[model samples]
Target: MALGRNISPGQGAKYYRKDDYYIEKEGGEEHKLEWGGKLARDLGLQGKVDAETWEKALQGHFPGGVEIQGGSMVDPKTGERCHRAGTDFEFSAPKSVSIQALVFGDERLLQAHKEAAAEAMAFLEEQVGARRGHAGKTWETTGQALTAYSRSCWTPILPHDGQ
Candidate 1:
């Protein structure tokens, strides 16, 4: 009599046979096991011996894995796109403004300088008072009269002038 062949074998027999042992344990479909195993290997997931465990691990790693069931196209700059299974994208750093450049070289500094100049002008006005009308002419006339009176009083005291 001929011996019957073991079609669905156990993990031990499958491993010894050098076949897919995890697939045999999980009773995974042939095509699913093939694709899932490829994805798991590409992602470097450990202990993913079957399709079920592989899928679970993938979902745990990427919450949005279902959104890219077939595949996803993403903008590399924004990282806002659907990604395909086993697709590895590059990580990008976020853009930032320099604090020193913003504070020292911005319009705020110009406004502060204007305010300081105005304050200085106000302080000068408080010290010297505001200029009244014809104040320059009045001061000049008073100085000339004082000089003339002083010269007249000292004229007789000089010997050459007395002679």
Candidate 2:
């Protein structure tokens, strides 16, 4: 199961841990950087997501002299401010798959799920649009989004006889 929602600038802080708990819970196995596309790469937002970089990216502050606020800049960069900082996405495997991975200690199963989630995010990024131009004469343009693999957890509920 997978779920996602737009993240506001204010809510960005809460997500900055970048999977620490998940890593600890998963026996110190770190989650891979599987999302964030060309835009993120071009902006030099790489490796593990740090709080500073995450915040900067959310506010449209990028390297090589580019600053975007409210989704729009001027002259060389033009667009209106975007209310959303980014999207919070979660991709969960079925219980059986999770159990299989856990029982066999198979990293491949988790990797497959991450890969699938990345593909979905990439596709959505291409289809998503953002507002541009001044308020009165605004237009819609393709949106560039940066996504980080925040965390993953599996808490299964099973019927047990209290063995």
Per-residue lDDT over 3-41 for candidate 1, one digit per residue giving the tens place of the 0 to 100 score: 211111121122222344324345444321222222333
Q: What C-alpha lDDT values do all the predictions have? A: 0.29, 0.58
Alpha-carbon deviation at 89 in model 2, angstroms: 1.5
Q: Over 4 Å off in model 2, which ranges?
A: 18-35, 70-82, 132-143, 150-163
Q: List the residue pairs that clash in candidate 1.
A: 72-82
Best by TM-score: 2
Q: For model 2, how does the per-residue alpha-carbon lDDT over 119-140 read when each residue is reduced to its tens digit?
A: 8877877766664556667656
